[model samples]
Target: MSFSKIFGGKKKEQAPSTGEAIQRLRQTEEMLNKKQDFLEKKITEELKTARNKGTKDKRAALNALKRKKRLEKQLQQIDGTLSTIEFQREALENANTNSEVLKTMGYAAKALKNAHQHLDVDDVHDLMDDISESMDVSNEISEAISTQPAFDTVDEDELLAELEELEQEELDEKLLDVGPSVSDRLPDVPSEAPAHREKAKKVDDDDDMAELAAWAS
Candidate 1:
């Protein structure tokens, strides 16, 4: 029978063979490894050139060093990617059955997704640095605000006025307690009555003296 007729007269859709998938992953890993190797070599060559140039063109040398550093960072990332791919391929190969293979594949896919989603170390460091600086600035602002002087509602003039009024009230209360009222003023003294009494007494004394003298003579 023809191959199609034997399989219900239709060509069945085939799943990717595990061996083929592992081979493809290995090929991709090898390519990444080659890229990483190239970048490393380029970085090493640039560093050597920078060192040989010495301090003559310091700015150029510094820029070359920076470029080398960037290349090295990229190389490291490529190496990590290759290693992860190789690991995943090995894991897929070791799965016992189809179900296990599927599970492993799913896990590998999820891990790749997560790797893509994760922030780079440099980004995380920069974010943390920014947050720290912001906190420091906020603290400084708060301290400055706390140290600033507060506004006073009553000034010196107003305070002195209130004090003067209180003193005046106290003095008035004391004067009222110590001083006499209008009804308690001294009474008027007798002057004419004393003169009249002296005159009357002198007249009586003169009459008595006359009578006595007449009798003696």
Candidate 2:
């Protein structure tokens, strides 16, 4: 049998895409909303008619109520239809989301595979080892460059002791220089302030400073 005959001479109809299905459902919902509004208006009008004709025209009032009942039934059916469409649309959206996520995951897997094609675990380890060894060699070279100069040949203990002695001498000179200023400041000392005792101590300090200076010179 020919292929066309095997399939009843008809091409299979393709199902709608998710997007198209959702859009169609939305359109149907809009149309149903309009239809619901129309039915509600008709029912309201029939109710008004029945109310206006109430005792004066029994047959007309009954007819109006019957029409209202039919319009209300149609409105209920449209509400049910709207609910069904909303449920279907939400389901389609979720399916589309899952499909896109799955597609992206597949693409990422392919990319990861391609990226690792030229890379080997052993080669990576070897590269890292070479880098670490080079860093160690560079650190050694830096240490050699920054080693202490010829100053290391000198005695640090002797130099430090001499430095301390020089600092002490400078401090003594400054103290002697300040004595004259101290006397000038206290020209009129109070009697009970032990001014004579302070003067004796200053004289001894001056004598000791003079002897030290003469020895150094």
Among all candidates shown, the one with the greatest TM-score = 2
* lDDT tens readout by residue for model 1, 1-217: 7877777775677978777788899899878878978998899988987997779988878888999999988988887888789788988788536767788999999998899787788999999999999999999999988784766345889889999999999999998998797667977667788999999999999999999999999
The worst-scoring run of ten residues by lDDT in candidate 1 lies at 145-154
Task: Write the residue-wise lDDT of candidate 2 on 33-52 in tens digits.
Answer: 99999999999999999999
Instruction: Report the C-alpha displacement of residue 94, candidate 1, in angstroms.
Output: 0.8
Q: What does each candidate score in C-alpha RMSD?
A: 25.0, 18.6
Clash count, one per candidate = 0, 0
Give the TM-scores of the predictions, in the order they appear. 0.37, 0.66
- Estimate every model's Cα lDDT from 0 to 1: 0.86, 0.94
> Candidate 1 has which clashing residue pairs, if any?
none
* Model 2 error, position 202 (Å): 56
Whole-model lDDT for model 2 versus the true structure? 0.94
The parts of candidate 2 lying over 4 Å away from their true place are 1-9, 157-217
